[model samples]
Target: MKDIQSLPPGPKPHPFFGNLLEFQRDQLKFVERMQRTYGDMVTMHAGPRPFVLLFRPEYVRYLLTEHPRDFMATQSAGGDLMEVLGESLLTIEGEAHRQQRRLVQPAFHKKRVESYADYMVQYTQEMLDTWHEGEVVDIAQAMQQLTLRIVVRSLFALELLDQIDEMGRNFSQMIEHRRSLLARLLNIYVDLPFTLYGKRMSAKRRIDAFIYKLIRERKAEGQDHGDVLSMLLATQDEEHPLSEQQIRDHVITFMAAGHETTANALNWTFYLLAQNPEPREKLLQELQTVLAGRTPTLNDLPNLPYTEWVINESMRVYPPVWAMGRKSLVPFEMGGYHFPEGMTFLFSQWVIHHHPDLWQDPNTFRPERWNPENDEKVQPWSYFPFGGGPRICIGMPFAQLEAKLLLATIMQRYTPRLIPGFPVVPKPRVTLRLKHGLRMKVERTATVVKDSVTMI
Candidate 1:
């Protein structure tokens, strides 16, 4: 392996602005072009600041796992994300991050997520019931509602469907406002009000208001509701119980990040399955054999191996959280590069997961690659859909369980066929979702019941 500084050379960036112009235009395309031009390690200057883009799995493993302390997460990029997430675990660092993680980890424990599985299946089935056979439905929006309902139910144990439309509107407006060019330009200054920055500020106020109201209601009841929200309200440290702001921040963080990523993942999985029927057939076959028309539970997860593999494969190709950025707090040495302190170092899953050198037929939609029989043949870090190391997504296990259960449940009931000539393109928004929606013609399958009767 070459030293960090001596890694593969990239495009010569213009002075002052450096590669900022190209990146601002379309980040995904810019990274793809750079990867094609400069194998794994690409050096580009973002506004006079030299940042190295590490694409190799080995390098990603080193930074995220081996030298974490040296290469901490960059607040600049994540700072924008915090417009919605607040100082949730995703943004905090060091001791504060650790403390927050400890406080929040209990809610996503295996038992807890398992308990939520029944709700996931039930909600998905309920949503599917509304889908008409010939009616063209937006699969993405449907999944969004299904997953959001599940999140709301599991998180608060409260019915939120009535308020869901409002919540979705505010959330979408906030994310868009923060993602716009004007937001980026305004972000150049640290002191600007979030309103001045973009449309997200008002959305934040609305969301926070709702969350705080919910928290206060729980507090007024002063009862342990046996839900995640109750657990959060019950959580406390020796010095202080989580402040109202803290509760609202973490709740809203999970509420938004929780459903959106899994929904997009399932949406892509369905779209991919539609485009490639063989994989879809295999997945359904596995579900039929393992589940036998019944809803999958935590116990059934181990048996539904193919379903797991398909979701993993989908994530490999289109990871919802596509990129990871770390700003060097101090100089670090890897691949022999002398990265200066405070420079942002990025490792994009889009680059590593799709690299020709790392994967066979990198661009193909092949879930079999993740099958146990073949997956062992690949390098350890060759594929990371939920990321790696200590900073890896904490909700990964929860998300996986939710996705697989939902996939199995839906496949048991309906077969969605993607409409022909409909342009299906992946857009790198907050998550990798269809720029448009996946319009699929869902055909209701014959309902299968137990007692020695089966129908397809």
Candidate 2:
């Protein structure tokens, strides 16, 4: 074991700014380089704050599962997230987090999440209807719009359907602002309309107002709509029911997280399939045999194994929530090294997913890697697209179901081909997004088997 006081190896930091400039220039490359040069445990700094980047799968399992109490989820951009997400489950910790998670858990229960499948297919089909065979479309924007609609419908019922476009715009602005380097470095709080911080604040207020209005309307109706919002409003602890603010916090958290990650996941999936024709063909074959051009239901998921693998592989290559961070609540030792209190640990799914030690051809798009017959058994914490352990994404079931249904529904009608020479770059943001958006030409599938195939 290494000395408890010894710090991990990493690139030397520039005084004052530390490694902030290097990190800001390109976070993905920086993290990958650190792991390659310094091995599993790498230390760096963001301004004055020192952080340790853990690269091994065992390290991931330890922080997230084995000794979860030693750390807490670090706030985004230093409390900028809390300003937007409020005291929602994403930001809180300890018993309060447990209680809130308990109250909100039922909304994401397997049965409840499965109930949204029809809506998922319907919205996707509706989006597909707008595409013409020869038209060029931004697939990233399209996925974002479709998921925003599905999440709103599932969360608030159809009440927010009409406001989807406006809500989407505001949400987009909020995300851009949150991820903006200028916003993070400057910590500008000027409330003027011209400032970046001001504009994001405005967007937050608009969203808050819209949600508050809906909450009031729902409370007045006093009827369960069988949507997540209704479920949350009714759930309570022994002391009292969830207040409107608390419910709004959860709503905003769900709205932002619920759609953003899934949208990017689909964007990357389509891009991967377009690039790798064999997997694409296999996926199409699976859809053709299993779905047979029919809308996929939750029950159909069992038969669509290749579809799941494609998504799994895509996430492994380009995880939506690419990185996660945690702050030490107390001094701890791991990987034979010790950390001080308030130390931050950053781990990247992108790096781990692409780690040479963990995966073969780590950068290649290979859905077959997930096949049980492949002979390479994936260890625990080896692939966590939706995260892991107790605080794993509550919406994992919902996001998976939505992605599968949407992919099946769209592939049955249209095959999106990436435009030739179109540059697709991954932007490390609140999620892994295409920096320039995914521009693709829509081509109608010629051989979509219409006759339903019997499930074997």
Candidate 3:
């Protein structure tokens, strides 16, 4: 407990605002500099609140796995997120999280996810079919649309592919506008009302309404559709089934988390591949040898090692859910840090993944580093794209399979090239997407067909 006083070290903050201004401009830069100067753990003041940044993988492991109950996800300032997320598993802790996880687990089972492979392939191919050779659009936007439709089909069982562009735009505005820099910077000021945010609040309400309507109609029908909604309904405990509110919360949570994260991962995947052709060519060669231009399946994924590594490495470089915010529930001393209950602790995958000590040539886009022989060199909590411990991404397997399948299918039929000098900056909104879209040109690959011997 005595070590808590020295809990990492950092440059003293400036007067009243502390490090808040500098942290807001670029949180990643602040973190890297702290690690460079302060070593593992560093303390910084966010307004009046003191935040301890744990940079070492070992300590991050302790926070997430070894001492999970000791920490909690810090409260959001506005308090709207709780209403939006409801008592869903993502927000809950202890017994509540355990119960919700049990109810939600079966829906994303390996067999359930494997069954979804066809829908993913169909959707990816459909999008690729529409792309005209030599034409360019924001490849990131294209990936978002593709992944959104896949989520719609897999999770909602809603045939809304044609309507996606309209719905997706509105949903995007709602997410971005609500979390605007102004809102974040001004969060410390308590005078403003929730409605002051204007249209974003309205958009969020509408999204909630739309999801509730779907839940109502599904309930009225009362038949299993073999999708996530159906699975949630089918699951129940001794006293009662999930309430209407519970259903809405889970649906909205899934859409927000499931849709956005996967899209960004795909966007980064394509961007990295476009920039590095050697790996792309190698991936294509593997596809050719393994499936011979046919769509990939679960059975085929294990053999497509390079393709899998490409996606894995892309996630390493730009993890969609960049940081985990935890507040200590009880006084506990950590590696050379003091014990203080209620202190907010941040564990950033953004920092951990690129920690120079953990990764070789940390900034380079190299996929081979994840190969079997090199994976051992990686450390715990240092490279968690889908998090770790008991509360790991339930859809981890499902997400991985969907991503690899989509990549294989698209790479087989078309070679997408990044438009020269396209602004590929990451906008760390709800997920890491391009502040400006990732533009790319696609060239169709010739399909090879071989005839069986029928000579008389």
- Top candidate, metric TM-score: 2
- C-alpha lDDT score of every prediction, in listed order: 0.78, 0.85, 0.76
lDDT of 3 by residue, 266-356 (tens): 8888888888878877877788779886778778887989988999899999988777777889988777456688788777777889988
Q: Which residue pairs show backbone clashes in model 1?
A: 3-335, 3-336, 4-335, 4-336, 4-337, 5-336, 5-337
State the TM-score for model 2.
Answer: 0.95
TM-score of each: 0.91, 0.95, 0.91
Model 1 ranges with Cα > 4 A deviation: 1-8, 75-79, 179-197, 446-456
Model 1 per-residue lDDT tens digits across residues 165-205: 77777777665565444446444533335553445777778
Scored against the true structure, residue 86 in model 3 reaches a CA lDDT of 72
**Best of the two (1, 2) by TM-score:** 2
Clashes of each: 7, 0, 2
